[model samples]
Target chain A: MIEFHLNSRSGLSPYQQLVQQVRHALRLGLLREGDRLPTVKDVARQMAVNPNTVLKAYRELEHDGLVAARPGVGTFVTRTLADDTLAAQGPLRKDLRRWLAKARLAGLDDESIEALFVSTFRSTAGEDVA
Target chain B: MSAVLRARGLGKRYKKRWALQNCDLEVPAGRVVGLVGPNGAGKSTLLKLACGMLTPTAGTIEVCGGRPAAGVEQLAKVGFVAQDTPVYAALSVADHLDFGKRLSPGWDDAEARDRIRRLGLDPKQRAGKLSGGQRAQLALTLGIAKRPELLILDEPVAALDPLARREFMQDLMEAVAEHELSIVLSSHLVSDVERTCDYVIVVVDSQVQVAGDIDDLVAGHYRLTGPRRDMDALPAGQHVITASHTDRQTTLVVRTDTAVHDPSWTVDPLGLEDIVLAYMARPADAVRDTRPALEVVR
Candidate 1:
């Protein structure tokens, strides 16, 4: 069973939040191909959202080529964000980790580093960054 | 799909006062539509009319494409749970379920029994002894098992504690998923509606302020804050729903999908509650600037 959760206070709509959660889980290796997503009825009951809202999330996921539904069975995670890009991101993560340690040693606090990261991230095209 | 509930020029007057006036609205089928507004906003009046409890003084209301409460067929198409979540206090839990089965031609006996069991309700316990939340559960079970094509609930969870409220709404969502029923739930608590309903109807001062799909409504409304300026300068498309002003600045909540081109105004997307509160806060006496009514795209 999917341990799904939603933050009603978040600015994002419920369906959009569910989509992002599935995407995040895929990226973090928490879910993968052939993994069955929780049924719409279960998520709606557990999360207290309309079943159509959950269906909308599943539809969007299918449109993005991340999931699919079988006639008699439940929806399944069909794929994740490009595996090649994820592989490519590994070394960049290592480099960023080392640079973050240096920045900390040079007295750069987390807030300042975060502010710098946000500004840089915002100025460039955000595609494939997540 | 055809509208499940449609009302045109609907009104109900009490002596000289109109409880609801010129309330033209349509609720789409198979959606959980919420009716929201402050007390005395005619939310109850509109719901009562939909259920055919009160005759409309001005116009008409139809449920499932037929006149509300016209006959046994019409009556069977709509179910109602009023503000108090009324259940016979003297009846035992099992007796209440049994009564519902006998009274409603379409009642699902097994489902009603299963709901009671799942709620951990004692079948032999009298309704008078059940807690407020428990009674509400029993009422909702009856409402759902009655299996009307549409269910109208008036503030069913208002008396429940936080956890109980969550459980109640969860059960409602589950019921909606399982049954082929449309729900029109009325609530003053925007938070409850925000979590439970997909469509929204905002009533204010005995009139329909706005009604539409929740996601579309939220996307179209925005708060624009900027330096002190006259309202007349805003573009014709930017219709103000409500405005608050200070000496140095003005913050106007407007309903429009047009992109804001002016750099001076900071435009922010509104959450459901913010948009609802803005509509409820509108001064009823104002001329309401002849902006077009929200198109009920049913």
Candidate 2:
């Protein structure tokens, strides 16, 4: 039921793109635990991709514990990760730390940074001002 | 990886012409192999012969260690998805499965149902009402769910859109992995082959121009661009697949198991598509003098 277009020109491989989209959906709570996924063939048909590409994405998701496949049944979203899961989120925390350090080094004061953050939020909230 | 399919001294002829001449190939099992060529290069005919749909005019072919044309056991172990996605248009998706269940001895109903549900396809949907992409999926479902040891797909994604094509290949790769099946598919799309296949067979001028694992083929073949020299003087191990000459230089694609470090030519790696085109571009009679070795024991 999730609808998203894969950008052919994107730097990410097709499998990575699918994994990102699915992760994004999970973050937004759009996809709940026990939610069924389209068959690899079905997604390929809908997106006009080779089934192998979808399989790759599904395999990644399965490896990440976000999805699980039943031999006689279809794949479904797994339940939420354990609290200790964050202990294993090494790459994500490293990326966040790097981005924050870069933002701090950009020479903006704390007040200016907060102001910039508020304005950025307002723009996405339907504000007319640029 | 055992030799699942073998073709020795295989040749085919039309009324007054030879389509494929003295072709020899041995394909290992549980690997994804690609057959590439231009139109009228006899790629489809080669697949037909492998599937036992057409009789070879000369030489012999064996599928899964047995003669394909002689019996149904070998043919049954081999599942063929032809150039066109041939399915019963009037039948429903469920009916197609039912027919497969009735006809195929090794049909896996659980796998078929799981795949169908994952794709969100209704069993009652008629094949004729399905879209082009859907028809292709259905054809694959039928062919793959039969649990054949060797799956031969002929241009299964050629008619699909770019996105659809990628998805179809992804699905195919997953199936190959899950079933542990050997696949030999034919296509003109190089990019698709690059992504999905590990082995390659180049068909040109009605013959198997070259066949090997892709990594080995690419690593072994070299494109040398430099001043012209007598190719007869080249070492015995270096076999020239194609040679093009300009005013002051000669560009040649050569196959050698050993590395060539000659100072006269700059040797560069060759792409699968480049090697395939080199063979397809050759004239039909150009290499007639180099007769194929015909000491096929099988």
Candidate 3:
């Protein structure tokens, strides 16, 4: 089961937030194939939202082939976005963390590190294309 | 889906003053519809009519496919908790539960007791001594225990503190799930309505200013900010709900399904609160002749 945390103040609709959470969970491996999702009624009651909102989110998930709903049973995850690149990124993540620690030690703040990463990445991608 | 509550040309009058007039509404099942308006916007009048508590002066209201207050079976299909969440102050909580079980047909005694226990309210406590929030919870329990197809709540949490209000709403959603019931909850708070309601009915000055699914309503309304431009210059599809202007620029909240592609304006989607308040701020009487399209639709 996936736990949905919605920020109503985030300017996105509640259903959209729910849909995104499911997708994010799937992408991050928090949710995987064969995991059951809570019924629309349960999610609505727990979140104190209109039930139709949950239905909409579930419908979007089903449309994306991330979930499948049985007639008498609940929705189940059928697919996930985790692929080979994501699965092989463990060492890359560890190295990036070490680099980030070094950058912070060198007095580069998070904003500067993020800016440097974006510009560097964009340039590298452009060079690859060129 | 079948509508649990339907009204056409629904009107109610007191002496010469019209409380509500020419209102047409259809509330489909499986929705928590919010009836929102100001104190004098005829929200209570409409609810009372649907509950069969008051007769209409000019129109008709039907609840559960039958006229309200029409007969015994008709009254059993819908439950109503009016403003102030009236409970027998003299009775103990246990006594109130007993009374509810005896009075309401299709009463679920175990469900009521379970809810009471979950709320952690003492059964021996006197209703008069319970806090406003507790009393409201008790009232809701009675209404939900009746197990009606549709439950009508009129500002059921207005008197509670913020925490109590939230808890009471939480109870409502739980009851909705446990019983598979549709609800029509009325409130003056836009935030509460936006949080819990899928459908909205905005009443302004004895008229329904707007009634639609909140998703559609929000998608249609927008705040367009741009350099000052004449209203006549805008396209016909853009029906302005409210407009404010400055020396250099104009901000208009308009309701339109058409895609806004105007290069000069920055179109921003309005939130539910903004959309509701926009219609409320500009009553039909205030802008009757200004827009023929709005009038015609109304």
- Name the candidate that leads on DockQ: 1
C-alpha lDDT (0 to 100) for residue A91 of candidate 3: 91
- Would you list the rank order by TM-score, best first? 1, 3, 2
> Model 2 chain B — which ten-residue stretch has the worst lDDT?
B289-298
Candidate 2 vs. true structure, TM-score: 0.68
* Candidate that would win on TM-score: 1
C-alpha lDDT of candidate 1 relative to the true structure: 0.86
Clashes of 3: 0
User: Residues B1-298, candidate 2, lDDT per residue (tens digit)?
Assistant: 5688788889989888988877888888766788998888888888888888888999998888887756656656989898878889899999999998887788998888888887778999999998878888888888888999988999998899976676677678778656778889999987677556767888887877667776566666788888977779788777777888888899988877666757667666666667777767776665543333111111
Error of 2 at B18 (Å): 2.9
Point out the worst 10-residue segment of candidate 3 chain B by lDDT: B289-298
Of candidate 3 chain A, the 10-residue stretch with the lowest lDDT total is A121-130
Better of 1 and 3 by lDDT: 1
- Candidate 3 residue lDDT tens string, A21-58: 99888888889899999987778667777677888889
TM-score of chain B of each: 0.96, 0.92, 0.94
Alpha-carbon local distance difference test for all models: 0.86, 0.76, 0.84
lDDT of 3 by residue, B1-298 (tens): 6888888888999999999988887777888899998898999988898898889998778888898878878778889998999988889999999998888889999989998999899999999999999999999999999889889999998888998888888778777766778889899898788778888888889988788788888877889899998888888788888889999999999878677777688667788888888988985775454434443332
Task: Give the proportion of true interface contacts each model preserves, from 0 to 1.
Answer: 0.71, 0.13, 0.40
lDDT score of residue B190 within candidate 3: 83
| Model 2 stretches astray by more than 4 angstroms | A1-130, B285-298
